[model samples]
Target: MHAAAATAFDATPIGSREAWGWRGRTLSRPVATASGEGWLRLVSAPADKACGKLWEGPQEAERLMPPAVPRPRLRKRLTWTEDEHGYLAELYDEVTAPTVTTHEPILREAPDLNDAWWEGLSTALDAIATVSSDRVAVRQEYLDRAMPQYLGIPIDTTVPAWTTAHGDLHWANLTSPSLSVLDWEGWGVAPAGYDAALLYSYSLLVPDTAAEIRRQLGHILDTPAGRFAELVVITELLQTTTRGDNLGLERALRARLAYLTEG
Candidate 1:
């Protein structure tokens, strides 16, 4: 199965042509761009569905950033009516660091991430986690619903503390040499340790990588609350494994689950 690239947009929105050039394709509908002076992104969604700020949730959450953390700064947003979905567009200052998600599908080769980069990512996550918000990360909800269908296993309904999370925290969404997590559309209040769990889940294919994530974020993943969040992440990964998404990590995820649940 061929993965679709965001670069193959059926049409570029009206305002985009005048302001920015396509920087690159992301894994989804939103395309990043170079706006001569700064960077921006083009987000599109169905028209009937009420189009507002492109990547509305992410943009709103970006507003909560503290002085230290690095994130794309949104300058302007424009929406235009279209035949199918409306064009939801936003322009932001470009990120200075290189993205870790350069490879088409999943990252085939790991980038040269160092201690500073990982430390920066951890610090940014810590900052985001301290924030308070009413926004809900809908993608996590959908994934929660799908977990039962995928795992066919009973879930511990014990609720955990919630806080602001980046929603999507894969390597592709993060930069190297410097730390700058990208794609905030999914950021919102989530279960404790949610971000760490998701990152660890994605890293299960690489034992050393997975271990490093656990080592750095162990404070979050070691708590009972963190363990529950990890279970949620495990369920999601197991689903992807069944679909043949991350084949290399299939055995590792199952083994991790066994270790996690054997208690």
Candidate 2:
């Protein structure tokens, strides 16, 4: 639990504690003197059960992946068990791998707008798309029209078919100063475009760097492997509608409608 605490939250002194939430089921105690500095979260067993049920399949996928080369021996203090819960435990274990490692988040920071970064990212996406497409479902037409209006793409098809993906790949989950990606709760097979779209949409929050990334990836986006770009956008919009708050749902639904109408 100590390792988990240090990795998930900042290192600081614990302050006041509070018990709050629906049915008083959840308890959040502040671990830092200042707000957002530290947190000690205690969730009910029922909540854990619910999460376990929801992520069963993805958990299995994680198990199928080869175990870490150097077996991860650190034991988290939480009551969660892979044997009892099966799927959820395995899934959590796999996603948290990079965090457990001394060297994680494979990328230290967003690479400069250069060909090398572009090529590496593009290659990685391509490899993931090709190797995992059959197990994942790619949504093509939905994204093609949806993303272009917002992202101004050199877009086209020939992008690998969709596959199981992290579905939600944003800066928050991607990097913690190092290159290791954290938070694997939302991972699953989806269209190859899902991750790409996520990066693009997030880019809207940082236009300059996003545009440069797009430009660097221009060749791939313009050529055969462009379909995944569209898939990424549509999947995120769908996620917003199904899982987001009212405002987010509205925005996502509007985007979906607009994309459909464009054709």
Candidate 3:
């Protein structure tokens, strides 16, 4: 992939594109001569598959980033073709968007994230539930199969209801300092507690903080409805295993197992 990236960089019209992030195999290059610049990126097969292709033919890239906030615009997508039907795939002349951070995300964090953060998040979850319900079912099955044995508890059968979800929500994908979310590639309808579950699962790395946050946000998952939150944790566990990202999978699995067997 490095050789292919080098070759693609050499052949393309852009110059001096640097790489970013672990996944995405993303590259950034200046598109104009001015101080403010445009950028381009290339997505390989694995990322393409992860994002899901709605159409057939050679894998195409979707313009994943939303244009500057407040405006909520979408940039045009750039497509590439395989060279010699093998090895490298390429995209050319892709325009980059401005990197300005909106003040809303920064200001919104403090008050919304205090003790009230969870409540706001729960409200967002409810708003999302009005949009979709797919992840609810997928997550339930994952828990039933993968979590029970490890946790020694039967999977909770009740659905926690539904919502729209970012599908992938984490700190890394979020812009730094301000916390504006990026990479909406997997946005979709989901169960009501989906985002809450994801945030909780990842928060396991800091058990005390996770506990505090969950406690503050307890209303979001109270009672039978909250089982969907557990479903979210198990789903993330299965996702980690499936993607070979075991860093937190074991701990998450153990925690989940404990949760199941405790009562």
Candidate 4:
């Protein structure tokens, strides 16, 4: 836990801590703040690695995204300097609902998602796609390189459209019973239908839920652009296997890749 960052925000940790993100670089917890009960996120990096689109994502989402989007509202921020490390603290409104999954990015069982919840999710993603941002979440250069290498897609493949996306839309980042999206640290411009495709990838382990995701988000996930977006996401997840992350999803991902590229 980042004690300095929490103290700077006038926040007192009240519950168990969650340490996640790249090698546990991000830590978050429920907190009691003078303003009200809130959630505090503490992100740290080596001094030289502290500046990037990802580092600025939460504040940028609060500034640019619409109110209709069900996400934690960023209320305050504190940045501090240490010897060779930097820490950033952000306080957000407490979301009563828990994530669909507590640990894994993929779901082992179907969540109790209703029509209204699905509708809200669709609407929120549509709204997010319309926001303007200079941040690049998925680069064309990466697509060009990774698609051929990971998915065996053509090197010259072109993405039909590009739009703003949550960038990381797996089960762990979404709330259940209510529709609050979490972790805006990677939101930015991506291939069109990227969020839906990413969600579909994470849902692959559960066939029924995967089918429902395809049905609910078919407008985006059942198109030429959507198909390409799935390949892009699959490429990314496949690449992550080199680091031994999401190993359970790798075989399923490769199967989907094969089905997508079947001629």
User: Which is the leading candidate under TM-score?
Assistant: 4
Decoy 2 TM-score against native: 0.47
- List the candidate 1 regions with Cα displacement exceeding 4 Å: 1-36, 50-54, 104-110, 138-147, 240-244
TM-score of 3: 0.59
Please provide, for model 2 over 13-108, each residue's C-alpha lDDT reduced to its tens digit, 9 standing for 90 to 100.
Answer: 344535243354434443442333333443344433745422333333344423321122222223343333311121022222222112221122
- Over 60-138, each residue of candidate 1 has an lDDT whose tens digit, in order, gives 7667877556777766655566577555555556566766765322344445678877777788778888887777753
Q: Which segments of candidate 2 are over 4 A away from where they belong? A: 1-124, 130-160, 218-220, 223-232, 235-263
lDDT winner, 2 or 3: 3
Top-down TM-score ranking: 4, 1, 3, 2
Stretches off by above 4 angstroms in model 4 are 17-22, 153-155
Q: Top model by lDDT, which number?
A: 4
Give one clash count per candidate, in the order shown. 2, 20, 6, 0
89-130 in candidate 4: lDDT tens per residue? 888999989999987788889899999999999999999999
lDDT for residue 59 in candidate 2, whole number 0-100: 38
Error of 4 at 162 (Å): 0.5
Q: Across residues 1-263, which tens digit of lDDT does each residue of candidate 3 receive?
A: 43445343443324655645345444434444233333334454433342332221112112321222211122334344454221223333333433222311111122224444344444544554454233223355655666555444465655556555666555443443232344444555555566666666656655665676578657665555556566655655655666666454566556664664574
